[model samples]
Target: MKFSVFLDLIISGAFVLAAFLWYLASSDNAKTRREKGDDESITKAEIFKSWIIIILLCILGLGYFFSFIGSLSL
Candidate 1:
């Protein structure tokens, strides 16, 4: 495989790993907050932020995939 393809795969894998870590950390935060009897609003905000990160990642990944496909057709 070409070097470019290999680089792309590495970057994509890094993004996936980052997202997974973000999710795990967020969940742990929420759990700790619940255990402390903190306000629900704080937990909700954390969850929302997590969702936003996931959505943004998905958008970026899709954009990269489509651009790669476009390049192939050129």
Candidate 2:
């Protein structure tokens, strides 16, 4: 049970960090006009990937929380 709680907290922190990173990435200045208009990277897709990862981590944490507590004797 204690282990589950600790894992949950870690996962929560990871989610928070991912959110902050997404916000920071979104808030970056637009590319300069002279830098080339046709080139683009998959930064947004990567951010989305991070979001998915964080969500999965949260789900795993929840599962661990429930399973651990349910199996423990009160």
- Name the best candidate (by lDDT): 1
> How well is each residue in 14-56 modelled by candidate 1, as lDDT tens digits?
6767777888898998999999999999899889989799777
How far in Å is the alpha carbon of 72 misplaced in model 2? 2.4
Using TM-score as the measure, which candidate wins?
Answer: 1
TM-score of each: 0.76, 0.44
Give per-model CA RMSD: 2.2, 5.3
> How far is 22's C-alpha from truth in model 1 (Å)?
0.5
Residue pairs of candidate 1 with colliding backbone atoms: none
* C-alpha lDDT (0 to 100) for residue 55 of candidate 1: 70
The lDDT for every candidate, in the order shown, is 0.75, 0.56
> Global lDDT for candidate 2?
0.56
Give the per-residue lDDT digits (tens) of candidate 2, residues 1-74: 56665665566566556656655554352234224453355554655675676566566656655655555645
Candidate 2 error regions (>4 Å): 1-41
Q: What lDDT does candidate 2 reach at residue 42?
A: 57
